[model samples]
Target: MIWLVSMYLSSMLFLVLGSVLNLGLSLLCLEKGLSWFIEWEIMSLNSSSIVMTLILDWMSFMFLGFVMFISSMVLFYSGSYMSGDMNVNRFMYLVLAFVLSMAFLIISPNMISILLGWDGLGLVSYVLVIYYQNEKSANAGMLTALSNRIGDVAILLAIAVFSGSGGWNFLFYVDNMPKSDSSWLVCFLIVLAAMTKSAQIPFSAWLPAAMAAPTPVSALVHSSTLVTAGVYLLIRFSPALESSNSRLMLLLLSSLTMFMAGLGANFEYDLKKIIALSTLSQLGVMMSILCLGYSQLAFFHLLAHALFKALLFMCAGSVIHSVKDYQDIRMMGGLVYHMPLTSMCMNLANLALCGTPFLAGFYSKDMILEVAFMSPINLVIFILYALATGLTVCYTMRLVYYTLSGSFNLGNLYSISDESSIMTSPMIFLSVGAIAGGASLSWLIFPCPYMICMSFMFKTLALSVSVIGGAIGYVLNMSAVSYELNSIKLYNETVFSGSMWFMPYLSTRGVSEKFLMLGELYQKVGDNGWSEYYGGQGLYFVLTKSSGYLQVLQDNSMKLYMLSFLLWVIVIFFSMI
Candidate 1:
């Protein structure tokens, strides 16, 4: 127990120190518009040498600082959350390994070195996801691991393609790739990899299912490190992608992911799953804006989203811990009266998520809308972006209504209260970040003016959506007819959205069932019939019959011995003649 406690304390201290160092480095890089790279040769090939490289720039340094900061807070929170578990030390080590993987990924600019970090993240995350050792955790871990493996395979393929460049350092030649169809194919593959990592569209099923992980893992992985890796990759490669033809496809798919996740969040009842879907929705937002060539805005939003989303998850964790693991929001209400600090934190995080004016989300999210309006995008993307933004507010408001308001529905409320200081301290710390991170990051990332020419209606469009969505969310939740109408008329749609548009089924059962049936058929026909008869059973019978004839010959009496000797003598006589 003392060892575990010391490990947690030391890990927290190391992260805090790292965060401070990186913050200073980030500020210096931003001031001078400078980047530093250090490389050490690992192997010398005939033409190209393999090397380990680290990159220090404003982007990497700032992101690293944020990751370390969040991770430190999460470690502190975990001390309380996992205190009773026998395997708390194991959990702490896994989280530290996770943070180390993220740090390696952030600092490495070379593809070869990046894969080290990339695969490490996938492996550690799978372990963390199944930490509970339950059937649900196992299944969710498999889905998460398999879903991310697609991205891992995509990265390996990309590395193979990039090998033709005579070096594994993508930062050097990514901008110089020939503008041909083959080059665009590479870009597409990179985007595909990014999509899987970021949970865009078809690859999105895993993000919500990963809620099976503990809330601290969710706060770290979903909010800042793992999911944002893809967006960060795209940001770094934005120069190359600008010339590729795949941006159109990326635009459409990312917009759809944003819309789908937002819609899904509204229908979700599980507290943690709801926040997970929100992370998915925000990831889509980052990806879509990155596709639109506003990577700086996307980066800004990514950092800001990380702050609030982590806070959101931690607040949700506090609520879950207090209620004895009840995660369904339908079972939670009047939490404001029982757990005021937690309720306050939850409300603040939800508001930040909704892009309420002056909050962290407002700074980046509003700018994204303005930029999207000003860009030369099609009407479809524009409408989807607008509707998705509205849906974000809608779901956040719905979450607030269900979890914080109304009557206390839990059968036992006596034991429910604000969590201990260890948990609430992290919540409070991140709550301040959720409130201020956007404005700070926005100013740092864009010191110059971000001028825009837009009409009054266009300027107010985002706020208008937020207000309308909030009103609808509240009215629907309060209405007596809503449940009856949902059951009678909109049952299918409700089920669809509630099930994340059936994406979990599609990715898991839909794919697994087909492969399983094929295996069964092969077992019955090939293994049991053809293979058994022709290979195993037939060979055994032939060998057995020959052995029996040999035995009969060997067991022969004097007559058989004389016959064999006579046959040998006849052969010798024929040869001599």
Candidate 2:
């Protein structure tokens, strides 16, 4: 308890201090960087002035503010919620690890610090994700760790490519580092990173599994702090995104991730799990906007989302506490009568999430749709995004209707009043923020005037769509219109058998040893496609599942055999030499 208290207090101080320092330093840096950027463009790459300016403009105060806000909120919420749990101290330590890591992530001037923070976060989150240490939680943590490591390799390559020629830093807006020759490789690697972190497509399986952690952990991880790490990467490398060869595929991936995940959230019955899936979808939407060159909107939505979604998850936790362990909304009907305060908070949050006008969701999401329309991608993508907006409304309405409105039907389960002030207060605070979050509020370093106008226009569009969509959704939930889009279920059926198409040759070793030699060796082979006889999927799958059988000799004889083989290979090399 002492360690936990000390950690929380230290973290709180860090957050308070960091927010102040970031505001002053980052804003000053951005202005300096911007001025230098203009001069660099005029003076050309040969001038030494480029290096001077590179130091100033490489980061943003607004982004730092985000990092601080998210880290602080996660810490505060975790401290309060996990107080009585057995592993409270351990959880607090992990929370500190994340805060330290995430702080490093935003301020990281070059790729090295970025990679360090990224790796640290991946490691710590793995521990936190499996905090319960049960079979299912362990499996989820392993999967998250595996996916994170896979993405980490791509970042490592990006660092290598940048160091080789791009002067080890982005001195200008368009510092074409990997050069046009390696554009494909760079794009491919970045896309891989985004896929893993943002929970896009095939890599998305790990996110749903992450819900095995505590609710507060889930609130922090799923809402913004970790899941949106990919978006942070995208924003950081916005300059590089333009250089990718597979622009169309990357764009499609983003849009598809957004629309498809929205559908999945609808099908999910568990309140928190639904929010988790929705988090994945919203991130995809943000990426799609970023890919379309809409930075302001993306940043705004990231903030708006943090406000509402985190609140929703926290409120869900409250409901669970009140009921003593029910997650599925099907098991929780008509709670509005029982827990009126909780119900009101959820309703407000759901309204915002559904993108209704005058709400935070409307403002950020509208801009995404607006910017996406300007891109030359398929019109079908826009239609898909629009339909997702509808689905977002429908599903959120379902949540609101089932959990809060209509009846107080826990099906004869004894009703309980709003129990704890600790839990309900956060929801109330967040609800207030959700209602007024985008209402002409000025951020310290961000252009308040520009943001306010942009937010208004975006909110108008979002509100219009959400209300219309919500009406239709309400009809469907009430059996007024019975249509299940089933888009979420589509990917499962299609990717079922064909998923084994991408198997990668791991090393020069025989089929047996090829499966060993750690993670790096495997990533290398994945990058270089060996479409030959042995490296193909069918045979590799058979070899890997049976890898346990190959351990054979536990004696020193095995070591002697390896030593002899090495000596023989060396002698052959000398003879050749």
Candidate 3:
């Protein structure tokens, strides 16, 4: 216990020191930019004293704050979550590495540092996710690593494009972006890279799937700053957003994704899936806000969301742990009386997440909408995103209802109350932030009454939408109308009357939906091309055929490998000249 406590303290201290150092580094970036080496990742280039390096600025500070705040809170949360686990020390090591890598990634002035940090976070998170080593968890971690690598490839390509243009350092390119068509291409690739890391559309299938990991891992990644990498990238290069259509595309996709994810969360049965989807939705809102030219608002939203979400996630772990790990709301009911304190904490976090007035989430989320409303969006898109927010409230209330507000069916364990201070300390701290964060952002608030009233009016409008929508959903939920469609509905309702599992993926018009929804169509027209050719059958046959052929040619293949090895050695020997 003493060792665990010491570990937690040291980790927190490390995060704090790292954050402070990042600020000085940020100043260096703002001042020197392309010249700053910024703690090299691997190799070094020759440098001159006269070049302006170290160009750290507000953006860097904001990103550093995000990485440290989440990592520190994650440390606190993990202490409680991993209390009795045997491999706690190893877990702590990976978490620390993840934190260190993310910190370095943000403050990195060049591609080398960024890639190193990027890969480091990926590797560490993979280990953390599969910390249990269960078959299910291991597969999920692989997916996370695989998806993250795909994102990294896009980033590397963008770096290649940037480096080709004589901008090897990230700070130089971001602070002084080359206003060219090639830069636009680089920005596009960068956006692709960001979306993959952020789990934005087209590549967002991995997040909900990653719930197989330990809950603390979810709290760290989903609720923390890791998923906000895309937003940070866009904010860090606000100049790039101003220069290309890539920014507009990003905003459009983010809005669409938020609507889908929020609605999808409303339909999900698992507790973790809902939070995961909400994480995606919130990132969408943040990205959209940032794209519309409000970096500070996005930053504040990112901070506020991380705090409240982390608190709620730990509360979730408590609920699951106390009740023997029930994730589906259908199985959990009336937990409020047993775990009163945890319930209250979840309630506060949920309300704040719904952007209720006077909460931290409200201030940041509201500002995003305010900024968004000023920009042009179709009525359909507006109502959809607005409705998505409403759905966010409904599902959250549903979570509260099923988990805490319903009738208790299970036999009692030790009477559930507040968790230990070790657990609740971080949660309480975050809950305080959730409650107080609205007042913290100065740009959005003022001391005047009429203005306050106007703000109330706007909130009232949003609140009205949320309440009414939730009320309708609640009625539908209980009316027996939704009951028929609730069970195994995604595959059936998605397409083919229960054949495909496209629940969260919204259907589009024309050939795209038809091809996706109507696989039978392809079966009729191109059975070999669509089904057997691409669906593991062809690969299996090819592998079988290759194995037999290789068995017959094994002696010859060995000789070829030997010959090739000798030729390579000879080439190297010659090149030595």
Candidate closest to the true structure, highest TM-score: 1
- C-alpha positional error of residue 205 in candidate 2 after TM-score superposition, expressed in Å: 0.9
Across 407-516, the per-residue lDDT of candidate 3 in tens digits comes to: 66676554556657777777777778678856654332232323322456554667787797667656655543343765454555534311113532432232235665
Ranking according to TM-score, highest score first:
1, 3, 2
Q: Write the per-residue lDDT of candidate 2 for residues 432-493, one digit (tens) a residue.
A: 77888755322432454453344555435555666777786666566622366443457675
TM-score of every model?
0.90, 0.75, 0.77
Question: What TM-score does structure 3 among the candidates reach?
Answer: 0.77
Predictions in order: lDDT: 0.88, 0.68, 0.71
Error of 3 at 14 (Å): 4.5
Highest lDDT against the true fold, candidate: 1
Q: Tell me the tens digit of each residue's lDDT in model 1 across 1-577.
A: 7887788888889999999999999999989889999999999887788899999899899999999999999999999999999988889989989988999999898888999888999999899999999999999899889988988998898888877778888888767764544578678888988998899988898898888888899999988889999999888888788877778888889899989988888877898988888898888888888888888889899999999999999989998988889999988888899899998988998899999989999999889899989999999999999899889888888888888986688885358787499899988999999888888887888888767889999999999998999898877876732536554478887898778778889898898678779999999999998998998998999999999998988796898889889999999999999
Whose lDDT is higher: candidate 2's or candidate 3's?
Answer: 3
- lDDT computed for candidate 2: 0.68
For candidate 1, give the lDDT of residue 342: 91
Order of models, best lDDT first: 1, 3, 2
Better of 1 and 3 by TM-score: 1
Clash pairs, candidate 1, are: none
